[model samples]
Target chain A: MTSASKSLTAETLIVQEVAPRDGLQIEPVFVPTEAKIALVDALSAAGFTRIEVSSFVSPKAVPALRDAAEVFAGIARRPGTVYVALVPNLKGAERALAAGADEINLVMSASETHNRANMGMSCEASLEAFGHMVAAARGTRATINATIATAFGCPFEGPQAVEKVEALVARYGDLGVDGVTLADTTGMANPRQVADLVRRTLARVPAERLTLHVHNTRGAGIANVLAAHGAGARRFDAALGGLGGCPFAPGATGNVCTEDLVSLCHEMGLETGLDLAALIGLARGLPALVGHEVPGQVAKAGRPCDLHPAPARKAA
Target chain B: MTSASKSLTAETLIVQEVAPRDGLQIEPVFVPTEAKIALVDALSAAGFTRIEVSSFVSPKAVPALRDAAEVFAGIARRPGTVYVALVPNLKGAERALAAGADEINLVMSASETHNRANMGMSCEASLEAFGHMVAAARGTRATINATIATAFGCPFEGPQAVEKVEALVARYGDLGVDGVTLADTTGMANPRQVADLVRRTLARVPAERLTLHVHNTRGAGIANVLAAHGAGARRFDAALGGLGGCPFAPGATGNVCTEDLVSLCHEMGLETGLDLAALIGLARGLPALVGHEVPGQVAKAGRPCDLHPAPARKAA
Candidate 1:
């Protein structure tokens, strides 16, 4: 349950679109480079302040995004929108920097089991590697966002400890990363856990410097977002049409849907600075690109304000 | 955006299962009488305190629930679980009474346009008819639950005024109904509106006597339930597997999903007195009965605590 007085808070919520990278990375089929670029352009035109373009990793590791360089090069970069790319190590960081990424999102799982399972290394090794990547970007104009994967819960390790996440974030803060992201890698977060963890994390990091990457695998994605936002988390990562999943986590579904999250924020009178209609259009068009219908609801159900015409007057 | 002090409220939340009636009523295929009875029996065995069996509307009006009598007659009633049925008029009330329903859910719409379109009469006419139905059940052991459909918003008409809902509930109170349900018929409700209206309704009615019937048409059903529950509403109506939709409202989905809502409540440490695993089994079996995939998430995503084994160790 939520607090009545707490629900009345009005503030500008920042939604960072991540469909181009996190959303498409897990797809079985590789999306064409042109389509990925078009999606990024469309998202930028729709007024998103931030968009994760693609991940610069070994093509063998994530073949779906093998065209990361082509995508970043082809997209029509908007003036105010920051384009980000996920970087796994120093080599990936070099590629991301060369591809003109505005920011590099370096990831390290909180749980050792998950870090080993996903990244093929121990948590300490991954952090040490991130240190190299952070140092490599020192002279570049691009900033760095250190993302702690499985920050909420790990499929291999179960619920994660808040102190573990705090320690990892403190390390990232020490590395001088521009921002920190707490990702619910398996969609295993509940509202209470999210609120508690976010509140604790905020005490260590600034609200503007923290972001939430939530998955809807268990249907708590939107609720967790509300809880985290209520706990002073300002930036949220959402995938258009609820695309993407964790290949390592069995039965894990898509990330928190972009249009759905925007709809929730807009309906609650929170400003998102994103055009919902444009986002819905892009979400509706995702099925053809991904070869299936997406999990986003607003495209199918329409907005709350979308009214239907009254039934035709019955014959007298 | 959320006050830290406000998250400490702990209260027992009640979830009223409504799949047998509201869920089946909108289904295009008519579920067999035996299957309906089995579903209700399984739900009763799952520890739900309340289960709506079926509606007593004209068979021609809702052919899917045409076997309401057989369903009500056949279920192995659980002593602690209250079996309810929807009744539209005096005749329907008589049938429900004969079929051994413990409670009769009377239906009327708050919006005049919806009331006329749904019930084929004016608001006053429906209330007057309910008066007759109430009078006819004077000596019966069955209680009455007055359900104001589209209490939050109407697909044909925009938002229904809070005064309209208050006046309707006042009339129900004057008629001596046992409980009142605010039905978000088309899923047009937002959290703020739900909280505002629920708070206003609770001021006029007792919390124990109020129920929230939410639809997930716009993905706000669960959020609305959280909002209303925070505003002092204790009872809620949910359909298993998110089965059901409003035939009158285009693109309207099912009621707040029973499994999903129970998952949220259980995760939040709220008591629902329902076995989630058993309920999920019943929800998963619904696709066979209704000839389509149900919209629930738990059946597909599994619970957050349902963990997977770690991947096999990779050779060095």
Candidate 2:
């Protein structure tokens, strides 16, 4: 085996479950606040080190997560599990901080067109707004992080330049954010691009502070994750049952499934510290929660080690 | 970027379209002979250098592919494209050669339980049988290759040993087959394992003569492909629209989607020589052909470069 593949087996990957935030944000139906809290509690019990519990966005803009504060208040936060809440602006940051969120995640798109359409501001304005939010949370316990959406490609703007994302990371660093996530908002990332970008970004940011958030829209999410991991990325974001989609990209699918990602990690001998069966159990319950079958494969098809009984005779 | 990912962009991958054979074999409804022929023809037109047209097995065993002979005879042969037919034994090999197939693919499982359950023979017996078939095709114009199913893992037997798969490759080498394919029948392959296996297998077989066939059952199909590609396996097997499932492993998805694989390769700057647009067009037509929605992502989401128009105003 090559040195790279050998090292992969020894590494530990930190999974940040984004189902409650990214996944539920786009769901057509609003889950009960209690159920949302239960989902986060289940994820925390499943051994996730970090969980994005909810978004502090406007209730009118995203009624699906309208009960975010209630859900956040109700969840039984584990001692080691960092509860994260996504905040759109200074107001959202204040609300999340007041709710005692362990971490506050801010988001802005890398592409100008996506920034305008998603955040109602240009890239410059969004970064400027983020500076005020960072300054506002200066003495708070919440570790501030920013996600650059459409970091790989945008539905409206197409493939993004790597330098544009690098510049955003630098800007986030200047604003004193704790970490940064490169979100493939529309699932436009390829493995090679992921490796190249991760390598370049890691040069600017520490491996522990960088995370990869990808969608499986075109079936390259897992591949991109592996590529980034191979390129020295340690943290990743995944959602339960792959329950998320891009509002702008009409047919785009959800984020990379958490159970599937965990299964792959365990199979590769990488330490995830997450229970596969527990994640699968949570994934299987997602269909009822979302009122539809999910895109996650591990939930439908059991793990590789979960052997099936031998047929009575030749069946295949 | 790492040197491994840099060389990835310079590689030209060989994709063998397996939808006409593997994809159709598990379908409940039979596709018309003309439609099967048209599918192969379309795949050839789409720049697939190799296409597994049909399987020369018992009609009662796989009624969906019962028109194997007719479909093989009707396809408009492209000069540079190789028409491959899957054969089980000498009789099937004779039929494939008689039907004017350019290549013949033989399959046997790596594990004893899978071999007994899939082919009704021991691994020893299957290898002995393949020897006879290989001898029979010694002087024929058709090139002979063997696929070791359950190469990475088995539903009945669980994870396979790399040494066991290596022994199979060595034995196939002794049989003097032109090529060999490592088939992840149930998509149990992880990227690290794929890399390790490919690196070992390539030591026994040349890069051009080795193919990796993986399913997306666990959502790691594309990741395994990239891992093998990075490890020096040049050829891969994928199905149109990700149609097909293992009869033994319930809920196992089809082979990796062809269009998505092609899209990933192109985006990574790897040469696939196939047209992504044409593959997507064929993938989009699969649901109507199969009477259900397929698992392919690119067909539903379009290619990464297939940009969508910007929203009129702030939509996200």
Model 1 clashing residue pairs (backbone): none
Task: Please provide, for model 2 over B197-308, each residue's C-alpha lDDT reduced to its tens digit, 9 standing for 90 to 100.
Answer: 9999989887878889989998999999988998888889999998888665456568998998999989988898898899999998998998988888888888888888
Interface RMSD of 2: 2.8
CAPRI tier of model 2:
medium
Best by DockQ: 2
Clashing pairs in 2: none
Model 2, range A1-316, lDDT digits (tens) per residue? 0011222232878888999999999889889988898999999899887899999999998999888788878999787778989999889999998889888899999999988988988889999899988987889877888999999999999888889899999999889898899999989999888989999999988787888999999999898888899899988999989889866445556899889999998898889889889999999999899898788988888888889998876743
For model 2, the local distance difference test gives 0.87
* Highest-lDDT candidate: 2
- Give Cα-based local distance difference scores for all models: 0.84, 0.87
Over B1-316, each residue of candidate 1 has an lDDT whose tens digit, in order, gives 0111122233666778888888888888888899888889999899877888999988887899999999988999887678889998889999999988888889999998877777888899899999988887779888888999989888888888899899999999999888899999888887788889999998888777788999887677787888788788888899998887866544445888899888878988887778999988888798888888777888877776877788875432
RMSD of each: 4.8, 4.3
